[model samples]
Target: MNEIVKTSAFIGAQPYSPDEFEAAIRAVGAERYHDKHPFHKMLHGGQLNKEQVRAWALNRYCYQEAVPRKDAAFMSRVHDRELRREWIHRIHDHDGLGEEGGGIERWLVLTDALGFSREYVTSRRGALPATKFAVEAYVRFVVEQPLVIAVASSLTELFAPAIHRERIAGMLANYDFVDDRVMAYFKRRLAQAPRDSEFALNYIKTNALTRAEQEGCIAAVRFKCDVLWAQLDALHYAYVTPGLVPPGAYRPGQATE
Candidate 1:
């Protein structure tokens, strides 16, 4: 174990009340959330042209594609029927029930408007290596981490509504290509993310009884924030300054015609 985990695991070092623990988790979001990333700032500020926007939509599809799989992986380990029942709704929200078409479908709508074919977006053929690595790491984290920490890792959703709101407003105001239909993903997430994050925050507050466990939960959120931030870093590195587009990753003018 690393020194940070060792320090966090030391019981009774700092016992937090439920409110304090919740604050610590929020603090992680405040400090580490990907909204602070430069690429997101550029995206929201209309600094990116159409292809840059397409690159983002394409790369982000990889994360959207992973959401239900990670949720299902977490659900698979739960023995409690009620918890499973509650958690199954997340899968429904992402993968959709029947023909309702959930978040993944809505995200593809954005990519499609950006001129990427559904096949290209879903195939993830254009995703950055760093984007794939970061997203897959999140799936593995949920699959391997203790259940409580796995749930806690999702607390990044607490910060999602603000970013989604920013995205909807910014994209609409800044880009001619963005309309309500193109931004349906963020609009839906405004409601879904809050509902999901509330349940997750309450779950952590109620369940993380020990100081060590609470710290671990905090670390989990921090780790998830890193996962998100890393994706933006990859985007900015490839599409922005010092533009080093890695092998087989999406490049400008490469969108489907």
Candidate 2:
């Protein structure tokens, strides 16, 4: 657990080789990713009810809607045309262009299947306060942090496909309400996350040239894991555990269209 919890895993007197650095980054996810969260365990193990699942999907829309804006914020601070060119596609992948559609649209498809009106999902007035805070904190992070560290924060995608696969299988098999159409967001991300993480990982490996920079990058990933884990913590608290659905936030069986 020390390897997982220690903040200084890569902040030693000497910097790690690219391979060691990559290993340390993956270690953060192995230990800290939301895949390990209790809420996700319940989610993927067929333990949550339809109301709880609806709450998860509804709150997640807040995060899903923010991704492209986060990428846009990152790209705004970047001066390198090549970097911006490579990164712009991230926004496209989320926001879509023309009629290609994108992750956000697919996510709304999920909410639609779950019976939420697009306006309700898009308004985000029903998301838990903590969820909105965590999502915006991430957006502000990519906006304020060093570009490489900001890029590194995205390395969480490296560990995403596993959870996506688990979600696709688990939700489909367990929930009559969940089907291939409802899982379209995660299925699409199976392709996009790998592509995006590859670029972000390469950028981090190449650009984080010093021990401090490398450690900072690693910490950024840790921060991102916290961000993701924190959102689930809030969801579990509001919808699973204590079961206080905070005023103005989403509650299961409320007005779903």
Candidate 3:
């Protein structure tokens, strides 16, 4: 692990010591993590109404569904037996192993509490175009980018635990509909994200040996931040302030009781 340090010379600089490179990547998360998005701020501050919260969960389901697929695509490209073995846990975490319901299933528990039918949520027909595009772009990014960068892209998990903590606390404090059961998805992630992120950060630091490679890792994290931030931008525009729900996207009142 590296001590956090600010640096502007991430790109086109001389090769960094592993600690400097790690610090540089962590800096990217410090500045660009989607926890800073206003939508999240509103969410954690209890400013959103139930419909708005429902909208967030409905839209976020799309991202949850795409995660396993992206991990699968990344695993398919890796030839290392040990790496593949290690990476397969991510896919299993989302998709589940046999009898255990995984993250996707846990997210649906939240949606179910929100009054959405499993069929409606999974069909994804109501998801915003922006959400669909951003998530698909992430999968495609992992498929198309170098393995190191694709792996590095998942470093967003490095920043996930804090947001999950805030979410759990805020929703529990503010909403009648929220409870321990609905919050299971986030509670699980507090443990899961740190484990996954540690593996990814270690991989990036140990494997990204040159200045150019390290810069690519940083760019990958930036691009992933864009992916996450863009989803909230769409959500906030459609549901929060301007309130321009896209033509085919989920509307606040559409969920079934």
Candidate 4:
């Protein structure tokens, strides 16, 4: 017991005030979030062709689909009833409640507008390998890491509402195929993201009580950012620049190129 306390003291050395800690967490998103990625710029700027847009939607389906699984993993590890109750909404938000519907369904609405069959998108059989790896890594992180760090990883939501706003407005303004219906996912997220991010931010700020814990939480945000950025990197590599589209992955002209 004495040794545990001594180790904890060492790990928590020079812990920040709550305000300072919150600032530090936000700084991580400012620096590392995927909004900085060029793919997003092209996506929002209407630089991508229909094919490129299709690829983005198809690949992104993997992430949207995985969100609920990661939340479930987090809930599985939580012992607190209140925490579980609070966190379970995240899953329902993605998975939907009965007839009410959900984020995943809305995302598919976007993809359906782009002309994907539900079978192809949900199968995830054509996603960039990196997309699969990154999404799985996120779920695994929540399952394996300390509960607070896993929750902190979700703090990327802190920066998401802005991007969703950009997506809704930019896609509608720029793309001929885009409409309020296709943009429903981002439109819904505009309200939902702020609500969800607030809970995650407060949870981390309150529970990441030690310096090491705080830094780990911040790094988790960076990790999620990397996960997001890497998907774009893979997309750019396979679809945009050299246009090498991986052997089994979707290319603009066909299901796989």
Best-to-worst ranking by TM-score: 1, 2, 4, 3
Q: What is residue 160's positional error in candidate 1, in angstroms? A: 0.7
Which has the greatest TM-score?
Answer: 1
For model 2, residues 1-257, the per-residue Cα lDDT tens digits are 01222445445568789999999999999889999999999999899998898899888998988889899999999999999999999988999999989899999999899888899889898899999999999999988888888999999999999999999999998999989988999999999999999988988999988777888888899999999999999999999889999999987778844
lDDT of 4 by residue, 67-86 (tens): 99999999999899999998
Q: lDDT score, residue 165, model 3? A: 94
Model 1 over residues 1-257: C-alpha lDDT tens digits? Answer: 23224544575576699889988999998898999998999999999988889889999999999999999999989999999999999999989999889999999888888888898888888899999999999998888877888999999999999999998999999999999998988888888998999999899888878777788899899999999999999988998888889989988986453
For model 3, how does the per-residue alpha-carbon lDDT over 42-158 read when each residue is reduced to its tens digit? Answer: 988889999999889998999999999999999989999999999999988998999989999999999999999999889988889999999999999889887888999999998
The reply for model 2, stretches above 4 Å from the true place, is 1-12
TM-score, predicted candidate 2 vs. hidden true structure: 0.94
**Candidate 3 residue pairs that clash:** none
Task: Kindly give the stretch of ten consecutive residues in candidate 4 with the minimal lDDT sum.
Answer: 1-10
List per-prediction Cα lDDT, in the order shown. 0.89, 0.90, 0.90, 0.87
